[model samples]
Target: MPELTQAQRNSLAILLDSREERIRAQMDAANVARTVSAGPEASDMADLAEQGAEERMDDAVVDHYRAELGDIAAARIRLARQTYGVCLDCGEPIPYPRLQAYPAAKRCTPCQRRHEHMHAGPDGRR
Candidate 1:
């Protein structure tokens, strides 16, 4: 694959940096939610149920952010290795627009779709 232009590199760097910042901010929020205690003891089943739901949601959010951080880190490694915009599957160049939309994408759209299809669970979720 051809090397990314200086302009494309700069643009992708900015995009990755911004995404990392946003993910970190969201992680902080999720962490706070997990750490914060419900001020009073639950008086009824409803309150307990609500607290449980909130905790689950917070955990899910934090987990998602952690995964996103990993993806961003991998993308940064690719950037440093001068392999940032190449699809991992077909070794073709990933389009700039797709990279702009998802800075951590490892595969081109078609390859990604195939990968998801292959890896999807019985419920059709990847």
Candidate 2:
């Protein structure tokens, strides 16, 4: 936003890199766990249940990590285009603090709230 100040860009980039590194490490660990936890050599209901739980947990972690990676990739593209920190729906510059908290944010607070509301289910969950 506003061409993103040099300091802001550096700070955001650092944050992105740190998050990316953490997620990548998590993916690696999850992959290893997936391999190791694929099954228990001993066949028993208890072992099968434990393995199933572990696999489910690893699946959740991988799903989350992939989503974050995709968001980071899109954010990087915006940065390259000099549009990082700009609200996609409002065409306004999102605050630096907001960007600091959410480097991949594509909408300002108000717009994001409205969007969530619009997309929320009848039970008022988004």
Candidate 3:
């Protein structure tokens, strides 16, 4: 793949930096939700059930945010390695528009679609 122009690289770097900040803030919110317990000492069964559900939901949110953070970190590493826009699967350049939309994207659209197809079920269930 050709080298990204200086301006393109700069724009991508700025986008990645902003993305990191948003992800960190979201992760912080997730952590806050995880830490706050709803009716921890409730005696009612319904309250207990609600609390359990809330905890489960909070855990899911935390896990999702953590996964996003991992992706952002990997993207940042790729930027540092000068491989940010190259697709890992096909070694093709991912379009700038796509990168602007998803800074952590690691593959070109076709390759990414193929990967998803292979990983997903016939019904597109992941």
Question: Among these predicted structures, which one has the highest lDDT?
Answer: 1
Best by TM-score: 1
Give the alpha-carbon lDDT of every model. Answer: 0.88, 0.85, 0.83
Question: Which is the better candidate, 2 or 3, if ranked by TM-score?
Answer: 3
Could you arrange the candidates by lDDT from highest to lowest? 1, 2, 3
Better of 1 and 2 by lDDT: 1
Off by over 4 Å in 2: 1-3, 39-50, 122-126
Per-residue CA lDDT of model 1 for 10-29, tens digit only, reads 99889989999998988887
TM-score of each: 0.89, 0.81, 0.82
Q: Which of candidates 1 and 2 reaches a greater TM-score?
A: 1
Write model 3 residue lDDT over 87-109, tens digit each, in one string: 99989899888888887889989
Query: Model 1: which residue pairs collide?
Result: none
State candidate 2's TM-score: 0.81
Runs off by more than 4 Å, candidate 1: 1-3
